[model samples]
Target: MKKLILVRHAKTEQLYDYSKSDFDRKLLPRGHKDAATIANQLKNKEIIPDLFITSKAKRAKQTAEIYAETLGYNPSAIKKEQFIYDGYTTSEMIKYLSQFNSGSDTIIIFGHNPDIAGFTVNLISDDLWHFPTSCTTVINFNIDSWKDIEVRSGKVELYIYPKMFK
Candidate 1:
């Protein structure tokens, strides 16, 4: 079986320097706390992933780092995928995930919204309109290989939001 944990990056500062790209925006104070809250919840539930993948964006990377630290995972071990930053497509995500070795039965992805939410719908055939910041959607696929994962192939396991922790 394969498990996919899709996490939306925590809340980011609304104000950004006009000179800097959106990719450079950092997380807000509440974002840090929200990230940690989810991490701690996963820790308590013993829901650790075999691999951690995140968007190259600063906010996503920071959220992934916080989760890694909270889960006692090596922050350096996190994998950064540039495609997640802009090439936010279900096909792109699946293609990237299919490249992982079969040894990795479970994985987590820290990315942006719309794409993340769309991915979930494509995988489970469920409409999740609002995938809020720092939210997580866990899906379990019966397939043995990631390549076998298809549209509506995954069963919705959990849908967690930061507000739930608060």
Candidate 2:
């Protein structure tokens, strides 16, 4: 069984300019706090991934860093993908995931929605309920290879949000 954790980066500041617009938006103050809470929850729950894949965008990178740090994961294990920055569809995300080495059983993808939301809803066989900011959804699947992953191929094992911690 392989595990995939889909994380939607926390709230971000509104885009202000065209210069590096999508890549420049940083996490808001509340976003940082909420991300910290979610990171701690993942740590407390002993949810550790073998690898962390995130969009090259600042906000997504920051969120992945915080979660990896709080979970005591090596910073080097976190990889940034340029495709995630522009890929807004589930098929694109799945293609990226398929590129990973088959040895990895658990992986975390920190990215934006509706890509994250769409990916979760489309890949998992169960209802998501919610995929809000700073939320994490864990999906488990039995596949011979990552290339076999497709829409609604996995089961929703868990869904968590920062509000649940309050």
Candidate 3:
């Protein structure tokens, strides 16, 4: 089985940063956070992903860094994939991933939403899902090879959203 954790980046700035290009917008302070402090979500989960990949966008990168640090993963080992920031539909992203990183049993990807949320919904069910900032969903695929994964075949192991914290 393959495990995938998808995270939509934390709240950002610059109308939440609409004027800012999607690639460079940074995280907005959540009250006293004053920075990206979203580590707690991954703490007790013991999430040590075999491969940690993130969009090159500033916000996504920052969120990935926080999760990596919290999980004791080597920050530098995290890969920055520009294509993620560029944007791709659910199937395109899945094909891209299957082509390159099939060796990993567990993979974590940090990226933006509507796309991220859309992919998760396609994986677990046909129902629509709203993926908020800092949202993290853990999905377990029954296939041994990522290339064999099918839509609606993924089982959602856990789904965490920032609202649950505050």
Predictions: Cα RMSD each: 1.3, 1.9, 2.7
Q: Residues 115-158, candidate 1, lDDT per residue (tens digit)? A: 88888889996667779999988899998888888888888878
Q: Which candidate is the best by lDDT?
A: 1
* Number of colliding residue pairs in model 1: 0
Task: Say what the RMSD of model 3 is.
Answer: 2.7
**Which stretches in model 2 have alpha-carbon errors above 4 Å?**
16-20
Per-model TM values vs. the true structure: 0.94, 0.89, 0.86
Itemize residue pairs with steric clashes in candidate 1.
none
Ranking by lDDT: 1, 2, 3
TM-score of 2: 0.89
Q: Residue 128 CA error for candidate 3 (Å)?
A: 5.2
Across residues 106-127, which tens digit of lDDT does each residue of candidate 3 receive? Answer: 8989987777888888889635
Best by TM-score: 1
Q: Of the pair 1 and 3, which is ahead by lDDT?
A: 1
* Model 2 steric clash pairs: none
